[model samples]
Target: MNSLRKEPLGGGSSEPLPVAIIGNGPSGICLSYLLSGNTPYVKSHAVHPHPLLQRKLMETPGVSIMDQDLDYLSEGLEGRCESPVALLFDALLRPDTDFGGDMESVLTWKHEKERTVPHVVLGRNLPGGAWHSIDGSMVTLSQGQWMGLPDLQVKDWMRKKRRGLRNSRATAGDIAHYYRDYVTKKGLEHNFVSGAVVTAVKWEGLEPQDSGAQDSRPLFQVSGFLQNAQDPSPQPFILRARNLVLATGTYDSPARLGVPGESLPFVHHELAALEAAMRAGTVTPASEPVLIVGAGLSAADAVLYARHCNVPVIHAFRRSVDDPGLVFNQLPKMLYPEYHKVHQMMRDQSFLSPGPYEGYLSLPQHQLLLLKEDCQAVFRDPRGGQKAFGVSLVLVLIGSYPDLSFLPGGGALLTMDPSQPLSAKRNPIHVDPFTYQSTHQEGLYALGPLAGDNFVRFVQGGALAAASSLLRKETRKPP
Candidate 1:
């Protein structure tokens, strides 16, 4: 119920912003779209598998779906998705086709510019965030249609460019391009502050009693610098807002092994560097087998790519092939045959001798102990004996964490402990599922992967939740 100050940070405008979104990923783009008053409406005669939900939506024809009784609407809907409301949105969009079937949309969007909220989206990269930095040729786990933003389908965009999908699969480069173009295509370009790094964000003092309610929210000061073509140097800037949204997805910070020689030049964390090395012929089949660590999809991708180049691969992982909790095991085999193939190799190689996989080898239940400067990897075998293997390069794909170092408490604020990284699989931020708001931080919201909505399709629902909460607060008159 706090009435914010109209004072400028330095020589800027006096009016304070209603919202300031962090990260220009899909979540940020979708939130910006909503804040711009590009409202979504349920089409009349919108056919859904859930007749009761459809009936309720049709009754309020003029209301935006974002403003509907989301929790009630989300009930009784089951999907292979995280957010139920997001599943509801998918149901509305695709109607009866809940599981990967192609169909027409049942929702419509209209620009109601008058309802727009004043906000800014400060992002480190362009629009796609982590997608921008992924290997160009690598295929995405999700289908092409699933990667698109709400309005413009990625397949539709590809048609414009005279491109077609191969078995509905989209490459990482295509997805990155689609998200970058979505911001401008949807007219949300003006709201994004691309190529800016947030240095620090701190909760400042609350306004006096004259500001409105006794429990007025603390003012948030965001300090950052812009990096762009105009000036390569850092241009310092400051911004303040009443509502803060953290849409920063987990990708910037790569999780480390903490072993000696892990930081060596030949050792790579992200896939981009390894891809670059492979493409440049720096890593060849004649070289010692490339050592890959981790059992995630990224690790699988590393093995696949290495083998494709005729390079022998020696994959190391802590988990066994039959571990159901592994990321590769969760993917649908038909859609992700490449990943499953790598998993199959792990399974096949487990019982056989080392040379059974042709150019690939799996070290199941192997624990890496040390790495020498000469590219010799020391690992503890399943038998508890330490052994060494020479390798051309070491690729660590153990997954990544979000860079929340900008916060005054650093990443420890979000993860509770930096030594133990925040993981979407294990330690996602506990938020109000309906509003995506942080339970401990008033006026603060989380979107996208930070709030556990990892998929591109689910991210919009998180955005919608935040926008709905924001609009509700905006409409309430000061006490």
Candidate 2:
């Protein structure tokens, strides 16, 4: 498993190098696995193995995983793990189990490819990416089957661990463990370099042309700091690649509610404290109501966690109460009674009348004006009233956007569709849906949630699309 070596970064090489994969999350891991032409890990019950995809990947090589934190790769294995879907077991195996089943298959696949292109992974910890920071016990929004990467089946992993598979959803811990196992079982760990952070990605203009014509082929300069040394200071280095992949998903930058008092100690952007309370079974009712801002899954989780602790909830959102486009509508009410109940209670609230629920209050189309130190929230109420509500804690979960600040030129090198509405323009990095390559830049690419495929199940498509494009480019390169 430790066969893959981390090569030192040096210049002056004329050989084609591996594609630099930034952010070793599921998207990056899957891309690397596919690009390596390793056999997909299929379980015993896997049906309709993806022979087509296997054939596709077998032709491509030279891919690597890069990340700032590598510890995330194995974080899930350390705790109670779950996935939104049976990602590892069902989804990945359903369409193509043969491509990604076991070590023997992977070895055989490699031998068949003949010329194995060496790939290197750079990171500070494991390649779990954002999953490492997730709460181990937190259940995913989707079922377990939908959470698998392209090769590993989460359901199979759970089965091997002797964990119950009856539950539709898997925990965050389950996903982390699956990633770590995938890297080890697939023999990808050797290629991984711990303690590396990609700081800048610069697309150097084409080499000076003797013919006085602009060269279409661009050389990319990827600069980073490697912290593998015992010393605290990071060692700065750079690598040159033909292409660059940005798999750093949106979770890195959380959307903020830019109101006054948001910096206060009582305000929390995440539910770590609430999750801890639920795990401890500390249901002691709070004296003050907990304020939850936003309408997404995180806000809903906060409401549920607060209610589980018998703490009063004051849910606030900008969406109208009657908005059918809410995320809750996507869930099956029969299976998720709490979400259904909460939605119903919120819907019962009226502008003219009080809500039926005594302890829970839902405020729609209201903006948080300020969060006072004494657990007080000033709101620009939807009913044209400036109201102040008492609160012990504030959970703000409006949503998250991608942070491409690390990109050179502050995102101007990227492009957005001018035809897109003003609101959509806020997300500036537009890419070809089929290729995942930036519409503006030639060699730059984006994948995962950053590319707009928010769900885990669909993330594989982005990776596949990007890999396909890069492989095509590789084939086109002159010998």
Candidate 3:
């Protein structure tokens, strides 16, 4: 096995640091918690489930009702049924449990002996990343169960707090609060360094090996600025670790509409900015028929919020209403009646229209030309037709890309292929899908949306894959 070696840094201790996880979002929280080996509290008595509920849970996706009881299923059946939280808990927390398949050996290794490797998490705040930056009222597109970390079920947390049933969607604040609580419950708060922004991650190359021997292991120098509680200035610090995991998500850099006058005072990108304007009474209903760009979930949110404020909206999309795989087409109407209703209304052109092309205008393959001084938008039709529309405000809800600005060497270390379309250019870090280790850098790993696993429920798989890879590397003999 590879032994830990101490490296002297700026007069700091010579203790070897095994892992450093960047960003305290769900991915980082789950990885750090699992690495710490904190045992979850289990009830002494077996929980009995109602016959009807037991049968129902047995058919659930990630749930195996035989070993795990059904009483835990009732609290949040909606969310829990979709995520693998219960499966992960059973594998990692239960005594002598088999993780099964290829993971059986990797996960069981932790229980065979005590782990003493040191690890730390760096982030800007307790929640960190997009979860901390999002608006409080923003509800997730996925169910609450999908939001659970590896060890703690979001349903169990909600039940303990008497919040609500597990089937409901979680608000941004709800998810953020759960993450904070998870850190405290897992005793990971001591390992977390808040208000610390990792400015750069540099590869220190491979250690010098004996002649004719190959060394695949690489060292990483992680440097960042820690914000002082009292002082405005930040203190610089450096940390060296054997492995690095980046989970800083994709919401760091938002995509922009490259049009003239995009910097106008009335243009906004996020829904929070528009809500703030409404609260300040700066934007009024008289500024009717707000022009919204994009066709994703964020644009839908802007439309709903505008409707709530009694403001009319001109929903503009680049594709036709009959476009394949639209957000509305995929959403279950019964589960999201309000969203379905609003989407239908927009399609039927029921809302007030400020232009000639009805309420629902489809600018199929359209190109935005300019945003005029008088709050007018100029765009070209798919067939070389040009049109102008009047609007009080323009909400650009275009999606965001992953911001890997902190990675030194620009494209040298991680490059966006020029062959791919502009939208897919900011592709996530390239990693071995099964291991989640960087294809180019040996010791670097990525998780969460930053690694292209966008859904919360599915992100746990990436974490597991990464953790398993780290364990194998750490325990393997150099030979």
Candidate 4:
């Protein structure tokens, strides 16, 4: 769909202008879609980290990421924790090719030295998936899953038969393509600014830096670096907007598992030299007992990957899956906007699992830890005489937190709520409950996971919806 010049609002003038959307995840893309055709009074600009991906989006036809395989590859790459080693390994290992007849046994030997913990892998849904486009942007899709659970019911109902499921992977660029098509079709492509990273947001009407010179002028500075350009030094830019939305998603950095031997070169984060290790036949089950920390989606993915590779796997977490995290609200509330804004805001939230939780071929969190404790439990091939490989790699898939060092004037602009102790380290941005505006400063908004603390518990859909709703409100003209 193309953007059309429409009759001006109130039959006087054209729509004033569109608002700017400063992030390119699902939330941001979805936000752009919802705002299109809203009286043409406001438009949106989606600021994407990768611009070339957005450019390539313009060539495709109607919005559809139909190729499932490409979708998996994209997810594998983008979702890789620190690097693409795991994906590299998958690429190199051809199907039906044996690392060794005793490949499972070999993997056991490696686990004792380290632990391969459970982690989540996201992928796209099957054929004819919805396409995201904005303006001239369009994208193509291939077969694969994109960091979400495969929907068996949907497939079964449509095809009336189930096919053997293959592995899925993707990269940041790949997903960006899917979104490009999604937003473009919705005629919201102009709402994005690609290749830009928002650095800091200066609040208007805030106190002066020195306080010695007092002048009440509302101004804020935004610093960011440009991509795909020849500038050697970190190029800086600034912005002056009445409102700023921070949609930078979670996983600002890999959460390190603080334990003995964690700092050793042999140990690595989720994105460590996965390809090299796999190619060398080094990534495998433990010869000693393997211990996995954290029992969330990431841990689940790690276990599944290891299982697919024929390696014996173990899973662990401080809490059970049924009680994954603290539940924000069990049901919708009768009264809205009552009591503390944060508390009331959470009443309508719900939790949805993205992958297989517990079932055949999938061991429970407690079972995995028991194997670690007893040292005799073997995860794969129960009937075989193979011994348990001692633990080697300990993959900690428990959880992640944000590191706010990137923001300029850090502590002065945002700080942790003293009332919440568990989330103190996270230091989530405290935004105005009603408008999603930062409480400490004006013209600054916090959306998505960064703003979901205490109330929302970090879900993707709600964060994006809230941001879009608030932005529309800010730009909407009165009747």
User: Per-candidate TM vs. native?
Assistant: 0.92, 0.76, 0.77, 0.47
lDDT of 3 by residue, 86-190 (tens): 334333332222222222111221222233235777777765447877776777787776577755667789889887632368788788889888888766776
* All candidates in order of TM-score, best leading: 1, 3, 2, 4
Off by over 4 Å in 4: 1-22, 33-177, 204-217, 229-234, 271-276, 284-291, 320-390, 408-416, 419-428, 453-476
- Measured by lDDT, the strongest candidate is 1
- Of the candidates shown, which would achieve the greatest TM-score relative to the real structure? 1
Across residues 166-195, which tens digit of lDDT does each residue of candidate 2 receive?
A: 357777888777787888787677556556
RMSD of 4: 20.6
lDDT of 1 at 208: 40
What tens digits encode model 1's per-residue C-alpha lDDT throughout 1-479?
Answer: 01112223231864557788888888888888888988788776667557888777777777888777788778888886778777777777666665546767878999887668878888777788888888778888877888877889888899997877766789888888988888878887767777778898888777442456566776678887777766677767787778889989989788899998899989989777767877888887788988899999898888887777788888889987889898877887887888888888888875245546787888899989999998899999998998799998899989888878888665455542345656765677667878888776878888888878888877888888888888777655221
- How many clashes in each structure? 0, 42, 3, 91
Among all windows of 10 consecutive residues in model 4, the one with the lowest summed lDDT is 102-111
Candidate 2 structure, TM-score to reference: 0.76
Candidate 1 collision pairs: none
Candidate 1: stretches off by over 4 Å: 1-11, 208-213, 279-281, 350-352, 411-421, 477-479
RMSD, model 1, all Cα superposed? 4.0
Model 2 spans > 4 angstroms off: 1-16, 39-117, 121-125, 205-216, 226-232, 273-284, 348-359, 418-428, 475-479
